[model samples]
Target: MNDLSGLLGRVGERKDILLVVLLLAVVFMMVLPLPPLLLDILIAVNITISVVLLMMSVYIGSPLQFSVFPAVLLITTLFRLALSVSTTRMILLQADAGQIVNTFGSFVVGGNLVVGIIIFLIITIVQFLVITKGAERVAEVSARFSLDAMPGKQMSIDGDM
Candidate 1:
């Protein structure tokens, strides 16, 4: 029971660290003074999600859990695209390219953002998998050690009788 509690506490600590990092990174990105427009919002959202995913990868302590990384990236990318389309429509309806760029920077591309997003997603997934696997290996060894000691404990108890 104590062991389990300690494990849970450690997990919680890691989660807290991840959350803090995500929050700080997102806040910093948002403070860059970009115009309060759709593209700026999308960029902020994507950066936040990516940082969160990266932090999760660092904290999960196993490679098998890395499967979650790609999923996160996919969701973020979809949101980014949806936001981009709407932002583009609004910009076209309201102002010219210079105004849009002044407000949101050159976030819109001829589909390059999507390609870059995909590449980043793939890289994150791979990195997460590797780290998760390493953590799993360590866990496996610890479990085995505990399992091996149990019978010895039982044997000692039997001898005491």
Candidate 2:
């Protein structure tokens, strides 16, 4: 029991170090040439992270409860963009990307390069215009409401005083 507690405590203390290491690894992937197998694994991990983020956003009770969401969003976006650049480099230089890219390119686009590119563009636009914009609007409205309610709240405090 003591050993397990000590291990957990140490792990908790090293979380920041772990995060830095992970960030460095992502940056390294952008510069290094990863094998197809590793690329596939990273792609799968990216998809899993995205799904987990979506679930977290859906199940969170309030925006304040997930205050780190914006940071998480930025990190994930950077990670994905790095992955895209790495994959593009592989495709251009070696003519082989990875299983995940090949599967998506083939299955989603049916081997039509133009259609695949168009679909990717459309999805990006929708995500930005619909999902991101909606979240921003909600945050703006919530802030305005909070400000509007402040006078009433202050009055209540004054009455109690």
Candidate 3:
């Protein structure tokens, strides 16, 4: 029990270091040639991360509760962009991207390029207009309330002094 607790404590303390290492690995993936199996695994991991983020946003009680969300969002965005670039590179050079892309292109898109593009655009717009806009409004309201409360906070400090 003591050993387990110590291991957990050490992991908790080094979360930032782990995050930095993960970020570096994501950056390196853009420059390396990943095997198809590894690429497929990474793609599945990306989808899982997106689902987790969506669930977190849905269940969060307040914006402040997830103060680190913006950084997480940025990192995920960069990670996805890196994956996109790497996938494109693989396709252009090797003429074979991976099973994930091939499956999506064949099964989801059904070889219909225009339909796939339209679906992609619609998802992007919905994400921007619904999720991003709602979050922005919540952040604005939170900031306004914080500013409005500042005077009372100042008064309390003055009284304490």
Q: How close is candidate 3 to the true structure, as a TM-score?
A: 0.65
Summing lDDT over every window of 10 consecutive residues in candidate 1, give the lowest-scoring window.
Answer: 27-36
Tens digit per residue, CA lDDT, model 3, 65-147 = 99999999999998898888888888898898898899888987788889999988998999889988899999999999999
Give the per-residue lDDT of model 2 (tens digit) for 66-85. 99998889888888988988
Model 2 weakest lDDT span, ten residues long:
17-26
After superposing all C-alphas onto the true structure, candidate 1 shows an RMSD in angstroms of: 14.4
For model 3, the stretches where C-alpha displacement exceeds 4 angstroms are 1-11, 113-161
For model 3, give the RMSD to the true fold.
5.4
Off by over 4 Å in 1: 1-42, 58-60, 96-161
lDDT of 1 at 146: 100
lDDT of 1 by residue, 8-108 (tens): 88878798676566555445443433333545656566668778877988898677868767655655666555555555555566553234444434443
lDDT of 3 at 72: 94
Write the candidate numbers in order of decreasing TM-score.
2, 3, 1
